[model samples]
Target: MTPDEYAAALDAERSARNDRARYVVCEEHGAHALMRRNGSGQAWGVARHVSQETAELAAAFLNRLKEDEA
Candidate 1:
């Protein structure tokens, strides 16, 4: 995914959930958004620095992060 794709996913997730507390974009890990609930936390991965090759993978990892929070 490119930067545009990452941005779109972020928008979608934000619209769907209202529990997110922060968004972190890491050079090493790409775009990561954090969600907190009941004092607990979760993270969702976006694209890897706007790169298409790693975007989907990062997104998948992020989805797992959300599940872990659950």
Candidate 2:
């Protein structure tokens, strides 16, 4: 990779661990859930919801790294 591409890749990896959430869809269950990236780079479920808004709200809270807590 070029210098810029390598830097961008590193930044993306850092963001995924620090402050990122995924909107997971469970088609089998017909529901959506908020999945947060854990310290160990695993998918951690925060909450499940039938609506998009609620799931996103939960993701917002779980994804942020509080300055006080950090």
Candidate 3:
């Protein structure tokens, strides 16, 4: 799937959750890594790894998607 599509899917899943949470996407070793963040903006754990492009897309869309969901 394309990076934007992947990011949309992730945002949808995150929006479906019952609690307020956030995620940070980063590039690691030529791959994308997702890190879960708590309400206080602290990193909790790494969730998954995706493509570098996907990570870039996700980072770009994260805030916009959250605002849209709100």
Candidate 4:
């Protein structure tokens, strides 16, 4: 997905949880963001550069390794 589309989705998700939350799209990383809150609340965002295919593959391999260790 394009950076703008991903950023929009992120913003929507954050805003849904808290309207006061602040979100800014990271220009250097298309899939990342800088998020914060005004008060003593949690500061959080996402790093989403990895493709779904890679994530799935990594999860599968990690599960297999865990099984072997057990």
Candidate 5:
């Protein structure tokens, strides 16, 4: 997805009350990374990679991460 599309999706996910945490696919230094915001609202990369495949994997990982935390 385009950067704007990613941003919209991230915003929507973050706003959803059911979502225990938010995951974002963002560009950094010409590459994409999966990020999550800390309790302090600072974005940090959970996984960094240059491929969309890795981003998809990161999304799945985020789901499991939430479940584990619960």
Candidate 6:
């Protein structure tokens, strides 16, 4: 492949690794956490949404983010 195309592919791989999210449960505490990568590419807990409304809002926020999905 061309140099520019190879660089673009490498960047895509890095960005895909950096931009992602997931949810996890703490069985003992019965708690939920929203984990995501921030602009600085650091994985952090966005919040421990304690209420249904807050949880839905967080979901909406993620949906609205629209990060040029491939």
Task: Quantify all predictions' global Cα lDDT against the true fold.
Answer: 0.50, 0.59, 0.65, 0.48, 0.74, 0.56
Q: Residue-wise lDDT of candidate 2 within 11-41, one digit each (tens)? A: 7777654554343433226677666554555
Model 5 shows how many backbone clashes? 0
> For residue 69, what is the lDDT in candidate 6?
46
Model 3: pairs clashing at backbone N, Cα or C within 3 Å: none
Candidate 3 displacement at residue 66 in angstroms: 0.7
Model 5 / residue 51 / CA error / Å: 0.2
lDDT of 6 by residue, 1-70 (tens): 9999999998898577545543322212454555554456566665676665566567566745544343
Best by lDDT: 5
Report the lDDT tens digits of candidate 1 across residue range 1-70: 9999999998777655534433344445444333223325555443345554354455456656765554
| TM-score versus the correct structure, for each prediction | 0.29, 0.46, 0.40, 0.32, 0.51, 0.35
Candidate 2 deviant stretches above 4 angstroms: 1-28, 39-41, 65-68
Q: Which stretches of candidate 4 lie over 4 Å from their true place?
A: 1-49
In what order do the candidates fall by lDDT, top score first? 5, 3, 2, 6, 1, 4
Per-residue lDDT, model 6, residue 16, is 76
Q: Which stretches of candidate 1 lie over 4 Å from their true place?
A: 1-50
- A best-first ranking of the candidates according to their TM-score comes to 5, 2, 3, 6, 4, 1
